[model samples]
Target: MSELDHASDPVVGASSRRDLFKLAGAGVGLAAAAALPLVPATAFAATPRFRLGEPEPAFILDPDVLYMNIGTTGSTPKYILKQFNDDNREVATNPTQSFGGVTPFRTLAAPGFGAELEEFVISYNTTDGMNKILAGVELNSGDEIITTNHEHPGGNGPMNLLLQRRGVKITRVNLPVGNNQKAQDYVDLFKAAITNKTKAFVFSAPTYLTGTMLPYKRLAKLAQKNGIMTIVDGAHATGMFNLDFQQTGIDFWGCSGHKWQCGPGGTGVLYIRNRVTKANPLPLFNFWPTNTNNSTLIEPRTNANAETYNIGTAVQSIGNPNYPMLKAFAECCTFWDSIGRGVIEKHDLTLSLYLKQKIASVWSVDNLYSPKDDPELLSALTSFSPFHTSSASVALGQAATDETAQSTTFVTRMREEYGIVIRNTAVPVIGSPAPHHPMRISTHLFHSARDVDRLVRSMKDLASRMDAGA
Candidate 1:
């Protein structure tokens, strides 16, 4: 059957994608997809039990525009916003000192993320966390760290800094895109690059550019087998996925609280594996507290059975803290807990799946930058080239500048004319002379099937007009 025919198939039709997503917003299928071991089962739920757009009232976004850029940043929920405001006022009025390293907030928020109180640190942001992880990890000269080419500046910056400061060798695996890829494909790519010199595996989960959710558990397992530390740029995973740090066997994770988590800006969650896990029975690697005030109080874990120090406390105690913002961030975690992360993830992924199906129906799957067929690769972010019928058409080196301009125009028109807020990304297509510019859309709990329909309609109309030189 044709791609369009398949997308509209009654078994997983447009109506079911929309209606089932709405109804299942509460909690229907928490079982993980058999194919995608890391993802929660609700992601594949055929029938949902709650309303899709019921959480719209929780956020205080601009009504004039449909904000679909949560991949970059999320709007704070109304209740959290109020708490942030009240906390700020109280802090300003009382003039208190933040000597305890935001322990109260960390204590309340750590368990939800599958982290111990001493393992979680409230960071300034993902960049801050990434920097701390890279700087603190004991990478000596000639030590190798394997990463991906599609990595954001957040991950790239720290890795690059390591190259300059510590003389660490960086290896990048070119990621494969589109419907034909599988989760194991990523593991195989990373596995091939591993060597005795390799000390760590660093990459993003649900890369911001293509919105591909890399199989973390599989990758972590691969790293663990090789006796390598795993450092994750989880900017999009914190609020989007119901992640368990210990379960994933990651040594270090830095995720943005402001993005999918809907917390205040400059707030993030950093997880450090201070104890041994079944996945990684090796002793913890030696790490220093580079960005902390209590460096003397922290030490590397030597035992596989117990933590050597409170790494979170050492890292989080960087002078006076942003009390109000951290408090608000903690409250935001509570808010997500109340709604259930699995339910939110199911809704978000369902909307994205609906959007991808619609885009495939019109543009064909060949133009998609994000994988649609692989459940493990699915994420709330969907990216595609609207102007081209196939990605291969833009593989030639000469179209990069034109494609970028066209993508920017598409994004601007989508926001200015259609009242939809989305962003475009420069994707590095394999074998291409230059990057392919594709627009990205973020689907979250507040979005619905109707929203996806509207976006597709607007995209179709806008692309048609742009093609006609209007």
Candidate 2:
């Protein structure tokens, strides 16, 4: 097969002897392939190239922990981790070449993502990318930016800052808290939000909190109709979904490689729509002077103000960035692509649906979240309220009882006593002064049918135990 063909093959697991032979052959040009010896007939063909279901060595996870928190941050696999380590080791051996060579860390980062060497700008994390877009954007006071109330604080806080500090106004569209919202529903809401004062329309492709997937293509087109810029906060989309920016045509995107993409913690990506970057008055790539008292003012002052804001110089010093981690991020994409996004999505939803079903049947839990078959409307995670009203009330009211608590005593009992890791969220209840709802749960690729079974069993045990004692 051609090198390009080899490039596209799914890397399932460890490298094969034949793969090694071919790799060695490529080293010597045309003559190497001719000189290579034939492989033994008994040797198994390269292990199906590390796809999902294959257990990979973990970087930071404890052997005993069942980590369902990939939604918060993912653990790096072994192969890409080796690359990150090697890169750091090389830097330690020859720090000058690694950090200040012809291709600086920022410049070296570009071609890795198949974009131009100049377009790649590295940030500390997803929030760093958000700040970059806000800092680099040129918006006048009273110009409105539309986003969602479903957004994580990472995006929401920045929008609030713009509202408070820059005099810009923000319009947050409230989404249906439960059930599958139709695609047209999103298009209509965006249409209603756009106006002459609308400068930008920013939202997540699949939001972190609610797990609602936006109609990105329609949103992109709507923004274009009103000459508004589109900024997508895709902290959950990178590895969790198949993302083709060219297909969506969004203006600006902020994604964290760590969450679903399973990259390093400090790894995140921001893409500026080529056309918007070209025409906008905001400087996309200039460097600010060290003498700046008001650095924020200088960035949005022009389009070419400082490339530094787009690409920070201090990444190497802070994280020393595991190079292998970046490669692993790419490899993780490759691995997900190998299984096919359609397949992974289907698998995740299947597991999620089964989980939801079992939770309903066994525990009588209320999945006040999403419906089955509307996979696009949700991710692997499913949030739920308890089946019993009193249980939920106690869960919600626990905070009032202890002002200085990390979480409720109920949650503490679950983790310390029950060995389960579930998330607690505060949602709105009708007629309540403060709308903090009960807890939610997250499901992911690493979870098995048995995991859901256990969850169902545990909830059943807890509910029964609570009722019997009462």
Candidate 3:
């Protein structure tokens, strides 16, 4: 080969994999430092081309701890965190230089979330948005709002408050558990619960309890058919699902940016269908907080378009909020967008499927808590029982509690002994008297097949060592 041809080859010419790792460690632009062409984030996307656990200079998760709990929280990328620290330092020194949340990030983030520019707001986690919307809603004594059993405190907290203060009745559908159910079952369960007294249908898409992605389109159809408003607790859906608020026709959705989006804590995205459209035109009760410019006006809120009024500002612009944190969130979303949402979803879903298979192979399919067969019911979260169960059935109540405790203990052992981080969710079985505590695992772009295998093997060994036996 000619000397010129040899010089141009990135692999053979000075820039080797070892040099690339060193460049990643350097405190500068990694691509530039390595003298390699900068590739878009989309280059690492789906189609199974890039191997898992591939070197990403941007991410800095600990190599020792196998973090399988992105469902609980995610590690921020090094670049974003560096900027966050720098911005915080700048504002700290000046003490008044930061801008409000809206203008800085509005245009850059809107398209990525499929939200109109005015509708998106960087709020404090999923619960913060839930509280704001719940307070803004109008209800009277005995008025009913529908939700499922799988809701977290963020969604349930406000509803519970209303139940105590205003006597609004919060009815819950006992969502069916296990992989035996179908998507239509969800529609039927929710449809059966709707009555003329029902004012709102609130539920989680892929609930935190079981990682079940309830059919939002079908459920929203039911809400629309009956003239009921819809509120979705989408804590785990933000970075995992390809969200299109207008198309889904859900009136509201609140999700955490930290969980799968890999943004900082206290950051999240809330989508409010601001305009009156064929999809959702129901007049909403408006309450502008004192933090926003809207607070000064005595005039009732009016709209130029669905997005004319930025209701999210009520939650976002409250008393000199974290400007640097909001900006970091915008960067995180841009990173996701450049990679392409469809590609990320596909890759995450693949890891989830692989983990589910590995778990089922050892524990048996019947032991799986999260759905396995339904394509529509998948997420990056997987849950299953990894405790000791006797061949002979144990007595119902206290025995159930004992077993669930073991499941919880098993999770602790995985972290302490195996250096694997995961979580446990206690869910109610159809006939069981007590809640079933299953180990929950979240797989993301950072995980590889080796990670999954090691995680599964570690879990298996730990279960035996702990003797999950009741």
Instruction: Name the candidate that leads on TM-score.
Output: 1
Question: Can you give the TM-score per candidate against the true fold?
Answer: 0.88, 0.70, 0.84
lDDT per residue (tens digit) for residues 1-470 in model 2: 11111223343232322243344343233233322222221221332443232233334455454455566787766666777777778767876533333225445444333333334444446787776676666676999998876677778777888888989989877665555356678889878877789988889877665456777877877776677777888787666655555446576677787776677777776665432332243323222223223334433323442342332332222333454445545555555554455444433444555555555555443455443334346566665544333123333355544421333444454566667766655544333334444445655545555556666676567656655752
Over 4 Å off, model 1: 1-52, 97-101, 295-297, 393-398
Candidate with top lDDT is: 1
TM match of model 2 to true structure:
0.70
Model 3 off-target regions past 4 Å? 1-52, 99-101, 278-293, 298-306, 388-397, 468-470
**Model 1 global lDDT (CA atoms, 0 to 1):** 0.79
RMSD of each: 6.8, 11.6, 9.6
lDDT value for model 3: 0.72
Q: Candidate 3 residues 271-297, lDDT tens each?
A: 777776666555543544433545544
Model 2 lDDT, residue 11, Cα: 35
Clashing pairs in 1: 22-50, 22-52, 23-48, 23-49, 23-50, 24-48, 24-49, 31-41, 32-41
The alpha-carbon lDDT assigned to residue 238 of candidate 2 equals 65
Q: List lDDT for all candidates, in order.
A: 0.79, 0.55, 0.72
Tens-place lDDT digits, model 1, residues 20-70: 434333122222211111123333243232234534456767888889999
Q: What does the lDDT read for residue 438 in candidate 3? A: 81
- Report the lDDT of model 1 for residue 42: 39
